[model samples]
Target: MCARIASPCVGLCSTTLGDSVCRGCQRTDDEISEWMALPAEQRDSRMVELDGLRERVAGRFLRIDDEARLEAQLKRHRIRFRPEQPPLSRAVELLRVGRDRIRDLQCYGLVPLEGAVGLTAAELHERLSARLLEEASRRRRALQACTDSHC
Candidate 1:
């Protein structure tokens, strides 16, 4: 039987902080509240959107030669992924594979940040996730400030 899809919550819920989007999962407050009520197909669609957002936010740090190599690595590691997933999404998965398996990210075409070589996979994931949240929070604060000033 196919495994059930899982919610994207990373256990760092920050919607209570007034973020329109959850800094953890990157889901909008509406999306998070309605997730359980949504049908499977709708949930899948929302997951796709979330993946795209993640890809866009983290794209700058990923460097891929092509999708084929990425796909092959993901397959070799038995990681579930869409066939036509974005490069950054695939890269993020590679990062999630943990440090030992992905010791040499350059082999997968991911550009390592200076001094990042010493960090473990989980550490890198946390760092990237934090950066994504920080960026989203910055944008949200800017929008709120603009709205407040205009009103």
Candidate 2:
């Protein structure tokens, strides 16, 4: 049997932002309120969706071959990070630093993808930042629309 899925609350609730969605956990206010009462199958499906969002929004930027390489890169760049943190959070910190310091990401095993190819480190960082922001904005809008329609 599969283990019971628990709430995705990261303790950084942002429901007060008036977006209906929690910026930290990505769950809408309604979902958050009803999480405990949700059926296992429904909860599992939501977890899958949240996981996909987490990966697309944050983990996609991490192109390292392994976690050790990522850790080394963080150390080499003097970027303070917690190994215990989620990969998404770590990737956010790693990508927030100046591109000059992390220009040669390949040296740290971060191979650029087709879209990132030929782009400078700064350009890649900007692209990733924009994508993250866009995703958040899209989610907020979606949640708002759902709320307006009472869905």
Best by TM-score: 1
Model 2 Cα lDDT, one tens digit per residue, 1-151: 9665576675657787675666656677878889988998898788667656655765555555566777777788776554445444555556656475666766665666667777777777677766755676687688788889999
lDDT value, candidate 2, whole model: 0.67
RMSD of each: 5.1, 6.4
Number of clashing residue pairs, candidate 2: 0
Worst 10 residues of 1 by lDDT: 93-102
User: Which candidate should be chosen as best, given lDDT against the real structure?
Assistant: 1
- Per-structure clash totals for the candidates: 0, 0
TM-score to true structure, per model: 0.61, 0.56
